[model samples]
Target: MKKPLPAAIAGAVLAYCALATPTALAQPEAASAMEEMIITAIREDRKSRGATGLDLSVYETPQSLSIINAQTMQDFGLTNINTLLKMATGVNVDPTETDRTTYSARGFDITSMHIDGVGMPFGNLIVGDIDTVIYENVEIIRGSNGLITGLGNPSGTINYVRKRPTNALASSIKLTGGSWDNQRAEVDVSVPLTESGSWAARAVLAYQDADGWLDHYSNNRQVAYVVVDGQLTDTVTLAAGYTHQDNNSDGVLWGAVPALYNDGTAIDYNVSTSTAMDWTYWDTQSDELFAELGWQISDHWLLTTSARQIDYQDNSEIFYVYANTGVGLDAATGLGLLGYPGKYADERDSLVLDASLSGRFNAWGQQHQLQFGVSSARSESEGLSYAAQSGFDVMPPFPGWNGREVPRPAFAAPIVSAEQDIDLDRIYGSLLLALTDNLNLILGASAVDYTNDGVSYGVPTSASEDGTNPYIGFTWEVLDGLNAYGSYSDIYQPQYVLGEDLNPLGSAEGKSYELGLKKAFANNTLLTLALFRTEQSNLEEFKAYGDGDGIDDTDYSDDFDYSLYRGIDVESEGVEIELAGQITGELRLQAGYTHLSLEDENGDEARTFIPRNTLKLLMTWQPQALPKLAMGLSTRWQDDIYFDSAYGRIQQDNYVVVGGYASYAITEGLSVSLNVDNAFDEEYFSSVKYEQVYYAAPRSVNVSASWAF
Candidate 1:
């Protein structure tokens, strides 16, 4: 009676009946005529999409998914989306300026960003419309999805998927350049409207520019997208979309400016030194609209309805100058010379609502699958600031020009006015139980309601707030490949504005756990190993104020309970080793690894600045290779990090990055490509500061051409 789970997937399909003969015989019997050889291996394994013995079965899906198709972002030339989200594996991407990019997983620190699956919470100007040449894949789900969505952010979740309209009539065009003077151009098109194609449409466009390496900085970008799909009467199916993104930058680059010399000695400079300071500036914008309706209530119940709308905006201004001679005149005569200034202004807005329902069931007899959802979000933010302290010739030798100020906006008081408004509502429900077919069981739960309304003008009056959160997880398939999962999520934040004006900052919480193992081999390879733990609670600290007359306001520190993190993750999760289906035929290969163990546990060692070891590898080769020409190679690595967690110091050191691409086809329509990135420039330090340090991105090259009519 307890053994019913599709008869344990029919007794593990008769005890792996000899590896199920490669999905029940992947077509053999060609008679002695022999000549059927088509190989194009592109299986950098992320769950090799296209299935095969289910990669050795036992996929309890408690979330740990990955898919980065689109021909591996056009064979590793990867355009944006923060360089293809660093190819998954606990994703990282903390650019912090030059259009600010932030996302950290497994150890938390991710602020929701979803497209084609809803949810895009402002900032960085919507990443220039997220083109990536129309995206046909890019799905990643790490852990803790609170039962299907409802106030998310468990350090995992990203789904891009767009790129519809197939049935022939494809198009593509791309061009790129790298290193300090980067440049880019992209365009993609897909068509099929009737002609028995069931209607379809797709479009993408992009433009980019860069001349940055700090020191006055520079960057400009633009993106656009359009999608359309239709079936209408055929059990109803319709999708529509629109998106536009823009970004402009000129400031924000605080890297390198401290080799000691504040009595601590050691200050002679020249490590390939660089500087040319300048007044700062940055601007951003974003827009999006979407709609989808898919109903196929029969064949196992399936219904989906989605709607979305978004708009975001940003503006920033910065300035830095302190060269009154040697170590900036010993910190401006110890600050009595008064010659440093700061200014900033920001605004944000958001609104979202989503609904979903999914199915596949058997109920009482076991074998089941279910997904239910509901979501809502509203946000608003505003901030304004100013700081001054003139004299000493207003310190402006060569920093984006602009000097002359002897009006201490209230005696160099700095920061003024801060505002916040937020309203959230989430409700989720999940179910996935096979309880036998080799043991599959996943349960979900979620309920969240949060609110915050704040203000600060001359200080005080940080009013209104609310909270609620709940979560749970499970997934078991303990053998035949092996799998074990766990989850416990929680979050509640309220600290008002970003920087300055403190004391009204409290309410922060988190808890997480994980364990795993997966293996498959027989030519088509894959391996996985994982262990994780996390803890965080109410940590809001900042204090500064004195009769010493330097004026910087805001202070608080006494609410710290936990802040611990631990990690270990490795994957190569095997299969066909490479070239996916070899242009519809088959062969593949891939690899990955990461290990980060950090600790703070209230002892306050000043929080170890992220990164504790990471490595990734990929390889693909399409057989039947010579005639049409196609090739690919990708490799990434990172280790040695600590960019100031309060005084921990040391930024992006130990590194390795290799990229490859090649394509050729002079007929049919037209095509040509060649790409290489970070071939080996390695100088490290993406960011770090006790005062400054930022550098990353040295080797790169690109060439592309395409056409189809």
Candidate 2:
């Protein structure tokens, strides 16, 4: 584990205090003198020294953007990354029975993930934590972000902004209990270190435990986060942060028995009476460290830089009954025989450099708001996987069965590879001109360079060099309180070695055009509509190159050809419409919807995993009218998927999931809340791969209470 430099720095500061505090207190007039010293210290901090130049308003931004504020998180009782996805627009998370989830944005792979504007290549493992108390907001920017984020898919970028300390001290403590013995507790605190509010700090801690709906399924999670900011002088500021999370789970409830009974009659997955036993267990942990420094060169120009490092590890055990049909059913329920089991480890490091300048300029007697920035990021990922057998017994097929591990795999040769490291860079410039009070025109473009190297289970050898991507966009304030915008962008992805002949693969290219409208109605409300088309060319795919299963020692190559993907997207897109400021006085309402249509131009379903249609809706009601009450409802719909497969054409029917929440105030600083997920207990499937169907979770409830000071 790498020690944090911030900790060492804190220790040194504390040491200095230990030696000086006593002497200062010893002075007879020290009490009055100390007050003056404290006052002076605060005045120094208030000189605007350590402040970031970045603006926080989402509307003032150039592209389509969304923000999930802290209040929205609590009203919906969204703690985990999965819950957040369900509540967001145009984002999808497909969770497999194996407990692995894949994320998708627009019509392309969701490759861009950031924390506070810095790229995080290994977002899969980093977002595993379920602590809503840690983040201040989730910021999403739609379209090519190469200019701001460097190397990334043109579909856009989503960044999780952490909580920061405010001058006024605030803290909250929460406790939760739910069905199936599920329980949780959390705390969040923020304070200023100086009276002048120059130095500030924030902290968050959380824990959760649950006994799942399925037999032998259980879960435990823990999280801690801390951050601090300080102003050193008139021109310099510094900030440091840390986060840690741990998760333990019994396993995922993959899927149930096939719909067909032995007699071939349509039957539900829950109706199967066949003898069965399966178990899955996994443990995952992660730690993150970050630091930043800001230098204000002048009033019109500024520079900022930040660095982050992430480390993660995982261990898993899976067991299930297997029948070859040709061979008799095996009774050996221990390791090595039943299902898939493996151990996974990952280490990643990242660095980011970002700087920008914005100021008003007079041209032809017209005032223009011009802004430009250059950003760069480099990241590396190293992960190792180990296969083993189960360590438990097989219980007969049933709804709820809890069993212990009966492990078996001994040591084996370690297969080592380095393929996850990524290096990316970009430079961008933009100019926005205010044609008139209600009219505006903007033009922007960016140039990017990216590279990747890695080997996966299927591909033993893989390496790709830097590829350039270009982007362009325009925005026009068409009418009073209405804005229209359009953009064109491109992105590229490399190839990995599959089975045989270095699978001939080349750079995959993507191009998209979008048009949207933003309207502000009476009473400070906002409404927006957007339509977009995206096409991808030269797509790389995994195809069988040999006669065998493509397993074992076989000639394989990183070879693929350009395929195509095209799709259209529509989103309601506005925020703070009904809930802008006044809602039942204290009651506030927020809501929106998103619709998407994606297509695989190759028409080869077996090669492309993209879905056709996705729909999402979210509504939040916070009644200040009652002073202490809040409620929310959320729904998601994924349309059917039809595509070409090796065996035959495959189709996955669409399904809908709904969730709701309600909370009440116990006092000015105390509150309680309840949440319901999959409220109808409806059974549905999210995906099907290799003829295997993965079902969604069942009805679940959670109740919580909180206190703040």
Candidate 3:
């Protein structure tokens, strides 16, 4: 199975062309040959569910759009969410803990995640690691999108388009082996339930077992998804599906390696080092059930309703190593290595319902679009903590440490420490008016009510908030292929984040403005340049790990469950430019560059750890000399970043990580690829939140075989 994969998932899913059958059970177009594979892989007409709720095209969205389609995923083997987001132009994926990650765009954390334009139950807080096998494409809309979401942030929104059942018979299988004993297998199949192809079902399953670059770290992940679609009537369609993802990690690092010495001197260690204990484990699972109905009121009108229920749970037994003062470790004698352990179980049940009516009409000699919707989401969470008796809590050796020599602590006496309920309700609508043949006016607004009630680890976590977010945009087609646009958007978010004092940090409000130019070409090719600014208050800033700030009282407990954050006010301004689709018949590319500046109300630099300049480049080309060969290159570069730590400043120099892939088509239906990440073996810190920081992975290689039909 040594071949080009998608020229064949592309050269099969394009196998069922015509996304036209809006009915879930509509027939899929039979895919053709690979002559236009590069162009087709770069763009999709149906990827129009972003920016506004009106399903506008990229040229009309008035915002930055980044898309990673299924063809790209199969080409690069981007089977995980974090890997996919890293390729997004303005987004950053921060892995603070071994098993937990936070995504950021512009200068703030990205809290919004949607499925098929419908908001997720709890923002971006899924319990398990996100697996991409179940998604058709991952779309990102940079800047505020309050018009499409009930809760909004300055960061962008990530919309995941779930893969549906195809009206035709299709299937694919993949096997991969990589560096560090990494192994993975995946299978995707679609079957027609009815002979006429009026009904269909699709299922995807995946499993991966891999060892990390860090010592003693390993991961085992599994995913299963199934969806069914049927035609109830000539104009009515029904679709339902379920998804399950499980992730279990062993020896997962909690915090990171301390960056400094207690004496205020910088300390550096090997990139492969880890403080995670050998016996520790973090296991999480997420299960969801969803249903959707669509009624075609007329050729120009459609009404849609969707509902979903989600259940998520996480259980972990983990350990943390830190200094007694919670600041830095001793340079000599390797002293003051304190060990902290905990046993935790958390569960969340969420219900979300959404309904909308969208259509087009002719008015004033022009065609206009309108969409209105109502949505409600409620989530209930429960958490239990078990007392951990750690005999190795104080004074352990640090030099030559890996955590394998450490003993696991005993846990007992579980107590219900956290119980909370969160709810959000909103009414939203948008209208796109064709004011003139060359100009358009877009208006939208959402009124949201957010409430939270519960107790978390002895802290009173409760709040009530209601706000209106309004959006306005203007677009003018300056030329036949160029459009100039400007937009204004606002954000209102209710927060449950805790501070160093252990109380809820409260709510946050923000506004964003953008002006940009878009150039569109044939085959959905797009180029965009944008200037944006934002002002926000009550944004949470990371303040080290643990409960107390060392100086706040001399007693630093070994409770690693509670991290610290504080509210702050900040202003952010940035410029971004991006390009997508084919540059030549043989080459297609997705590239972006961003320059950002963040400052506090007092004019002091804020969130200094965020890079001021970043650039992402991804491109693929099929050489004419070798018709069966495809090659691609990916690289991400950033400016220097620094963090003000307790003892001193932690900094990382500008660095670039490079990845490349080569695939050869063995046959039209099967392929093999060799992908090398960090091809140059560049080493840098992935994060610098505390005295401890994480090191980026070194060079790794994987060889994958795929079969598509």
Candidate 4:
């Protein structure tokens, strides 16, 4: 019999959760409405400057963009970015580890993450899912971003806008419990430090714990955030904030299930089967602080400066499984999977700084906008490794095994595993020319100096680059509420792969071109259509795998994660269509579709591991007659993806995942919500790069109560 999915939550502080409010599912908006939204309904306002320092609207940004505000997140119970991004258009959330995720867009790996228009740098090979409670909204920019983001990555950029302190008193608490013993609690409070409201502070804290669908797996998370904002004088504003987070997962998979047998036949393991031993675990902790200064030099001019620092640490003791012989993996007996264990720890510190001056000036009898800025991002990573105890390899489940069959391995003396530094410094500026009342042109460029020094995992991680990249765009108001735009930008990404001469290769360089159209309708609605193409060379392609000594590297040919890289040029072209905003007084909607094609210099298809088509849709309805209730549904669909590896052909056919939610207001200050993910329980693989793959999670449900005051 299936176990009951119910639980009692502790701490019932009755603050309003703000659950039933009919906040418009606001999408990205243009720059014409920033001022009025400064202090009211800020979460519902569409203000995204993450693409360029200059303030611009989503339709005016000249790129494919998407935005999901706090209300949308709360409505859907999207407390984490992994689940949040899944409902976004043109994005692929690729899960490589149970606790980590990699995002890709436009057929390229995303390399940049930003908070409040500042770059956040991390050089780790492993990245965990980020909590979203500290953010007010999330903006996704799809395409090459080289103008201000120093790094010319074509995959796109993810920008998180932190929740600022509110001038008025407000408080909310939400408690949730559901399937697999999942439980969560969050508290938020904002208060004016001064009665005049010139000074304010806000704090938010969250905790979560849950068992897993995978046997022997359990996890817990904790997060805290504190922020203060104040108007020191009539024209000066200052803000400072701090955030801390911890994630721990036990009985985790160091390696996933083997997809194929030694005999080359597909092996289907039980959905609940986990290769992790009872003693294995992975954990990460992070803390960050930031400060910002804004000076209103004049009515139309402003100066802003910000600094941020983050300290991160991760520790893990993992066990790896592999085939014992040529025909070792026999699914029938499960005798072929052998285990190898390792212990690792990494401490990473990153800092980012930015200063910009922006203002409006009259040029040619017209008002024009411009911004100039300098920014730098630095990350240093150091790690320690311990030798594992002997005989640990023979302890995994074999003939008649259970999770506890093997004892925890003893570690030998710790040794330095890595010492590395990655830094990027940039000087950039942009100008918005008012060609006419209905026409505008934007010109921007950045001069960047990037360097990577030291070694990681015995490989020399040395690279230095200095160059200038340009960006240009044009937008025209074709009709009363429509816009047409075109954009071009340069792309750059450093490489660590060795060349034929055993030296590092040059950076991958490319160009991106995009043209699009957007329409704005009543009820805060937006529609967008875009066509884009990008081309690049020096993208490390597969080379021979050997000892991995920068010479004859010893590795698998299709090990995308560690495969040897050789310079290769590739091109990708795609089309995207999207819509966001209220469809009617009773309905709010957001949806998008993308079609992409990628090819190598040889005209052969490239990166077959990435799908060519994807679509996402989400909608909410609240009838005026039934003002106390609201409901929503979301869907994600993708084309098939396949990759050939040492283990054989790995393919995932096209599939769709659906989710639903509903909320009811019990009172003006209280509400409750029910959320169901993977509603149809569709079985599908979330990734296929490695021999061991992961199946998407099964259907899960959650119910929550929230109070807002």
Between candidates 1 and 4, name the one with more favorable lDDT. 4
Off by over 4 Å in 3: 1-48, 121-128, 499-502, 544-562
Kindly report which residue stretches of model 4 are placed more than 4 angstroms away from their true locations once superposed.
Answer: 1-46, 121-126, 324-328, 331-333, 391-401, 496-506, 541-566
Candidate 1 — which residues are off by over 4 angstroms?
1-95, 104-154, 161-192, 195-199, 206-216, 222-298, 301-329, 333-359, 365-367, 370-431, 434-533, 536-599, 605-690, 693-709
User: What is the alpha-carbon lDDT for the whole of candidate 2?
Assistant: 0.53
TM-score of each: 0.29, 0.77, 0.92, 0.90
Q: Can you write out model 3's per-residue Cα lDDT over 578-662, one digit (the tens) per residue?
A: 9999888889999999999999989999988778899998999998889889999998999898887667888889999999899
How far out, in Å, is residue 162 in model 1?
2.9
Expressed as tens digits, the lDDT of each residue in 603-683 for candidate 4 is 988888778999999899999999999999999999998877665787889999999899999999999999999999988
Best by TM-score: 3
**What total of clashing residue pairs does each candidate reach?**
32, 37, 14, 15
- Give Cα distance to truth, residue 86, candidate 1, Å: 20
Task: Work out candidate 1's RMSD over C-alphas.
Answer: 23.2
Q: What is the overall TM-score of model 1 with all chains considered together? A: 0.29
**How far does residue 476 in candidate 3 sit from its true spot (Å)?**
1.1
What is the alpha-carbon lDDT for the whole of candidate 3?
Answer: 0.78
